[model samples]
Target: MSYTSFREPEASPPPSRPGLLRRLARDRRSMAASVAAVVIVVAAAVVYLADAATKPEVSNAANALVDTPPSAAQAEALGASPSASVSASVTPSAAATASAATAPKIPRTGWVPVDNTAWKAQVSAYNALKVDPVPAGVGNLPEFRADCQYSHSLPDDPIVAPGLPGASHMHSFVGNKAVDANTVAEDLTKFTATSCKPVQDHSAYWVPTLYDNATGKPVETTGFRVYYRSHMSNSTGQMPMPNGLRMITGDAKKKKPTPRGATGQFYCAFYGPGDLDGIARSTNGNWPICGGDATLHFMMQFPDCWDGKHLDSPNHKDHVAYGAGNTCPRSHPVKIPAITFDIRYGAKGTPAGYYLSSDKEGKSASSMHGDAFVMWDVDTMNKRTKNCVLQRRTCDNYGYQK
Candidate 1:
């Protein structure tokens, strides 16, 4: 009777399932948002600390990087992909590190020495081809006497000056030798200028157009550009010039004359290697001529070619001597033909002076001319140059006179 009146208990409503997005959104405040905020703050703090820690380290390490190029370890560390920690570590330093990595470095070539033997050979070859055979071992002559002076009139003057009284100012060194340029410069300071004193320091024997390994004939290097000025006496206090070097006027119209009144007057002197005889000893004294070390005095003057003497002399190789073909005290300015200084070392075509190349054109409108080795600055003839007869000793010194 009771069962008949009993009704089924109402079924519990099926549990409602929450959606994934809804569950995540509902959990965002408790688990995700708060955790994410804390995580962000901690990450920023780590980055700040890392930045602070690495700045001084990077600053100190930057100079070291310059001195010693990056090592494998440093490079690998830089290339590693960034994680949270890595990003914190590298972000502040990335710019500095990139700069350090890419900063310009002195090329290996800068520290390395160049072999000048090729140039030396070129000079020798040129001499061998000349009508007159250049003498052997030309630069081995003994030192000039302390007071010895070169003759300006005669073709050869024994212009040998002694090293300084206490210490030799002139150092006897050759190409790329182990001699301190500064010490040699100091010695040059003690050099007292006489009429015969050369205008250059630290002569390195050379001859133009020499062939390979031939050593055909050596020439006494007459001039060079030194790093410091050794002669304060010669300077007019107007402006400082290269050390142990003198500036002389080459071409007046093309170049300004020497401010200190120096002229293009230069004499030619020849020297040969010394033997056991006293003639060619290392002693500071004049070298005698006629087999006494083969010293000869010559001037840079140009004699008339038709005079039947010194007529065939050429300036360099295959080039007409300076002022050649130009008459003296003549009706008009003499036009001198220009030749290229070097086909291999210089630009194509005949140079500015004389016209004598396949690329030769008419003469330049200006009387002044230049070759690869010599340039005339037409600003004024009064301007001075490092040397009167340029040898183009340095890279900067190359090009027609200027």
Candidate 2:
């Protein structure tokens, strides 16, 4: 976690003190030379100070959390004026701001801190009834799996601050042993282990849960399964997720919304995974819901397309992009593995019922948001992505040895 230190060479014996030179019986001209040496040193000091003043502070991009304001299109339907100015501020200091272009370091926290207060509100145009088709031959393909535990007591949610319950919204988490709104890459990677399938991937994954606002009790994803694989047709293999990759989808501000672009899928089960006929329901294509005899199902999909440069973005979702119809674009050519969530929560009510922190009313899925914190063992990701996904082999526990 600590950067290697470089020991400086001993300072040149202080320019050989003039007093010592006197003992050598130096001439008067030699004394003038000594004075000249002192003058040179003073001049050098002045120059160093002036240069330092002009140069920007070495912004330890590690701690920089920058954000810009939302765009006009984002505020169009959100009741805010499109012309509203966004505060492109980086917290921690303001005099010498952190460069928006600098990629932050994520070695310790497994998550890069970000500020999305001003990101362009992703419009409904982002998703036009687009549904990532199910991976048809899951059993025959190599897949990375994570068996995340279901927790009613909040697991550490890395995006939302800890203990300050009503600030943003409520969420449940799985994977990293150490996670919280302020969590960093180190927190997860340095932990003893994780609660997910790839124990080595110590990152946290979370989603907002529906609760009965009246009761103030939380629902559950009692059992969670995360499957990661190549989501592109032409890609032979996938790239490992960079540490500190933070992303969000779905609008947490829309009082009533539907699932469009974000990986917000809900349905009912009838003895199988993809059986959604009479039971599948959603509000205007926003939040989908399915209620059955046993439980309610939630499925989410992350973009397999990546820009290949950033681990985190100002808005969190900008760095990575979604593939078009399961084919990655040249712009986001690197095919990082895509993950799908198969979540089930116990239910006892009608199909149209669920709760979100954004709107206690739970009437609209518009306020829903899903946060993802990505971190993993470099070796593990490389092996699985190359061997299972690229090779088109179905595997459990990686399906092959390194």
Candidate 3:
């Protein structure tokens, strides 16, 4: 399946031709150092990008596979990370040991691509743990839903589930539910031999809503922020992120405003359909809340697919690939980041200081956190009014229309 093109701001023209390195070197002290650093970084980036461009053949041939695990090298290319902990391989916890008693079952594939070298190793690790396969049975896990989390803001009002007009909606990016936080924590402790260190001040959250796709008019919404604390922290029991989870914001839909104006000015924000705008000025890399606020969520327990494709499951519209080339938000092209990981679960499994802040291994899988996943037809919580809305109407409907 394919996704619609996300409306993007007119990209500024490529940087003006810079003076040659030799010419720049002729300049005085600090400028020379900065230029040399920039050159080195740019060269490294080019090489990584070129290497990541080679798409692996996702296959079930089993025999023609390598034993390499996904690592930051590969993830950096894809613009995403694999899983936390690129070093420090930990032995399977009691949970994995108990579950491993059963034979590993290879997942069936076809719907999406699973060609990355790192992903294959991840699949192997998951199989070793005997985690349940993707339940939908169509293909590997939905690429968009498989990772730790893919952050983005909505461009239109979301559609709410039936019978829950005013119900709170939490994102299942990692498959943790409001009621499953405890279970998630238990499983984390049970899976790793490392002493379980509790993550602090974390909680689950869902700000569902439906507003005008064009006018930004709201139809319905839930208005409160749900905190999450069940996420796993490193063995030192220290929070990896000093500022917590950064606010992710990007308009993946890439929808053009009516009359053909640039909608790229929209920044990323935490709550409200119309909250926040633009990624650069408001993202973790910028001021006015540099790196912004840190928000955490429970990642799904089981491994899914890693092809980075859209999910076309029944009951769901398969928005990612549904309208390729269309103006719809989900039709945007799939941009897989370079994420890194390995089957080695011990202390030496991955690099230090890069993975999830919740784990001992610092190395994390980098995902396309630039865009926001849109949730429509749902009653989203509004902090300003401390109320909610549903389906183009106030969530408190009590009558039928003629």
Candidate 4:
């Protein structure tokens, strides 16, 4: 399988690392294009086809996918093998965006709606432990980096709205090409060019594409990177990501900086060191544009603990919970690998900010929502990730035959 290394077509060399202030004011734009997501073993590419504005009614047959979250039985089934699909019975709803008069604090914990409250005490204990992953943006650490550009828009969201069509907000997929609403854990094991490095990790990762509500057009997600090796690298023991492990962080309903979703966050990236400045929002947490050499960046950390019994939760995210002070909660005592996404977009300034697919502002990143639908072959994960992340090796170029 061939993976596409991130580089713009005949693009200028990456600009020299500029000042944080300059980067914040005029962060450079990435060389981007449209694509179509296809599962090709060779480069297993996602062909670019920027259709964020298209909203094609490919089929009017009441899409069983992209329609709603899962039911109790359905969640239980998928926890085993992400092959089940959400029914068209449920509808998606986010709280209305608050007025823009003030920027609210990001909530302490994420806005997790739970069907099983059993983890509450665990969460409290977990929170009480105060063992959080090393704080983000600690650029001083020896960070592992693997950069790859995006292939295209994936209207097929296999994780959130699987097996059915149009049941999910469109996503920008990477790694596996065959992933659609119907993709399963078995499908991920087959060889394919993944967008992630160390190619061996044929795991798929994606987020809702950002859109400019002003123009109703898609914003270039460009290519992003995978960062590993944090300050806690040596202390934490890791395990492979179980198949069908699904999670969602951040609220799509928040248009501004509201603590309603704290575990999920939205902040800015300056080229230099300074406190992350707050951006204006539209009630649903849509950030205003950067005024300096700043760029918009998103960070999402997955739960480090698992219950060892369930793979998914009825609420789609309540099954796995965050570790307390870096240690897995007793309820979720099984310590798996901790995954965090540090995504930076090449954009700057306030006139036209961003929104995501399900944003309340109509196809904007304004009400940015993030979802992670993972499917990895347990065996492949044992080596591709467990060995490297657990052993504290900053590995890249995955899948290259030894």
Candidate 5:
């Protein structure tokens, strides 16, 4: 009866179930552990991002970016032409840049050589021309003359000391009026204003200024006759004087004493009852004093042969040479018109005499020198050389053989 009444001992009270507060405490501890794990993961991610931002990017050999020029399509997408993109990306090598910097620059203006194809063609054409035969009794002088007056005075010599103003002795210039220390071949060709009679002759001529010893004044030339002639008897294959041909006659540095009959001495020019060496002698025994209506005159002859290579040379005279007998020297094979300067002064000469600007110490006429810078119309020069020189006839200022 007692066993029946019992409720199976209440199933042992469900094994003493836990309280609500204890359960809550255990759940809070588990939640705190999970939150700490999440915080640690977030901190590790933040540190990785910060290190990536601060560190410099280094190139790995296998993954290095190539700086190649953009393709045409890529350049177009970037709003640039392909050529511009390529030029912008490329750079000159250091060696090329250094070579350009160290290379000698060719001068634009100066005594440049005449070695162009056009000039060579001109030489060939000149050589191929037919020489006209000389008629009988044509005076036998293959020559022409340029009558020039005094142009201006300057202490400048374009041939001797180019671009250096006042570097030369005082020179009385004739022919081309625009001649100066800075004068070039182009200048003479362009500036056609000349003191010479033939307007086509744009050449320049200069000589040292003659100074009177007593008055200490410069004596300018009254007349300057430039004779272009050939000294050879057989005047065949004479070429026209090249434009920009420059040469000097006589030695300005010759300080030797020039007596009355000395070579290259200045003498008198008279007609009747007078000597070519003048009547009296100067104090230096160089200059001559005329007795009659004679005045001081000097003749300077330049070489007739050219080297046909340079427009000018170092000494200015080595490029030219006087022809021997009837033929030019092998070194200077081109037969050009020889230039002769017949300069006349108004003074009759005195005992004190005169001194050339080039000869201050020597006070002699032996130092007298003349410089010629030739320029002319190509047609005129050719015509004169053909008609007057090759034909062996004397031509006047108009280049006509009468």
Candidate 6:
């Protein structure tokens, strides 16, 4: 009875439980796997951040390549100078490309086709005309005059420093009243206001302003005479000057001493008997002192023959040449009217001397220069060339022979 009581219903053995050591081992393995997964996730995130940081650098390098200037070889292949810097990013429009392709190539020497179609047609018509025989015993001078008065002053030069206002030194302008740095060939025709006689002459003339060294004040011109003449003795076959012709005379960069006998030294001009080389010399020996009723005067002359191709050249002088004896050079076959500027100023010389606006050193007056931008009515130009220049007669402003 005691044994039976002790056995109290043997409960079924508790469901087979996993050993504690085995469970612990399994949990440790799971922990190790989770740790490895976290490490992998961190490594992936770091890689993503590093790759993102490098992408901008790569894009910047690509853009730099696109903006690089053309190489020397590439420029040569494109018919451009190696020194000419060009942007690779700028793509020319189709219309511009076509225009460039059709444009005439500038020649290294000799005549080339005129680039402007309208001008080319005019040239052809003029070349086809029959040249009338020059009258016997005609005077050697074949000239027409355009007497101009000073119009205004500005620090602009359309030929040398176009479109850049105040880039140049102060200049005294005559003839065309609306001339500025932004003026072009068409603008000369459009702005018809002029300070010259025969209002038809809408040309522009400019020279560096003369300044008094002692007062630092500008001495403007009182008389500006622009003469259009033939340089050749035989004026046959001379053509009318082309519209939009530009010319420059005297070297503005010349800084040499202009002593008493200098070739282009400023001189005295008066009606009565007075010394043309000034009454006294300046301290620097470059300026001349005028006597009573005398004034300062300068003369600038331009070439008379053109290349018949370019309206202008890189140097602004390569397109024209002075005739030798009675013949023009082969390269400049087209004879044109020569331009002469007689500029008179009201100031007399002082001991301090005078200086041109182009002269920065105030040492001498050797930097004197002049520029001419010629524009005229086509019919008027033609008539003057035929009646005065071609016929070897001196004509006044009204195109009438004097």
Over 4 Å off in model 6, which ranges?
1-116, 124-140
**Arranged by TM-score, best first:** 5, 6, 2, 4, 3, 1
Model 6: worst 10 consecutive residues (lDDT sum): 53-62
> What is candidate 3's lDDT per residue for 1-402, written digit by digit as tens?
111222334434335635654444354455645654554444434332322222223224322222232343223323333221113333543433333344222211112122245433433332243212222222211111111221222322112221122232232222122212112222322332211111221212222222222243332211121211111111111011111011222222232221111222212233434223222222122111112341211111111112233221111222121111211121222221111110111111111111221111211222112212211111111110011110111112111111
Model 6, TM vs. native: 0.69
Summarize candidate 4's per-residue lDDT along 38-145 as a digit string, tens digits. Answer: 212111111111101111111132222311222342234223222222223322112111111122211111121222333333323332332213333323332334
Query: Worst ten-residue run, lDDT, model 4?
Result: 43-52
Best by TM-score: 5
lDDT of 4 at 204: 67
* Candidate that scores best on lDDT: 5
**Model 1 lDDT per residue over 1-402, tens place:** 001111334433335744754655565546645544444444444433442211111122211212221234322322322211112323433333433344322111001111134323322343233122223332321111111121111111001111112231222222212122222223323432322112222221111211111222222222322221111112111111112211111121332221111232111132545421222211112111123323322112211101111101112111111221122111111111121111111111111112111112222111122111111121111111212111111111221221
Worst 10 residues of 2 by lDDT: 50-59
For each candidate, what TM-score against the reference? 0.16, 0.58, 0.20, 0.55, 0.70, 0.69
For model 5, residues 1-402, the per-residue Cα lDDT tens digits are 001111222222233555755665576677766654554444444332322211112113212222331233222222211111111232334433343354322112222354444445555566566655555555657898899999999999888887568999999999999988878788888898999988989999999999999888999999999999999876755777878878888888888888889998888997776799888899889889998789999998999876565566657776677876676655455678999999999999999988889998788888999999989887777777878887778788875554
What Cα-based lDDT does every candidate model obtain? 0.21, 0.52, 0.22, 0.47, 0.73, 0.71
- Candidate 4 displacement at residue 295 in angstroms: 2.2
lDDT of 4: 0.47
Q: Which digits, one per residue and each the tens of the lDDT, describe model 2 over residues 1-402?
A: 111223334433345587765644455456656654554444434332322211111213322221321123223322222221223332322211222123222122112222222211221222122322234455556566767885333533445443233444567777775665446656666773677765776767787767744466677777778777666554442444555566676666666454434434345555755435324444344344443454556667777765444455445565566766555454344556787777777754344455675576645555656677777675565556655665655655544422
Runs in model 2 deviating more than 4 A are: 1-138, 151-157, 160-166, 257-265, 272-292, 325-327, 397-402
What's the true lDDT of residue 177 in model 6?
Answer: 98
Error of 2 at 143 (Å): 2.5
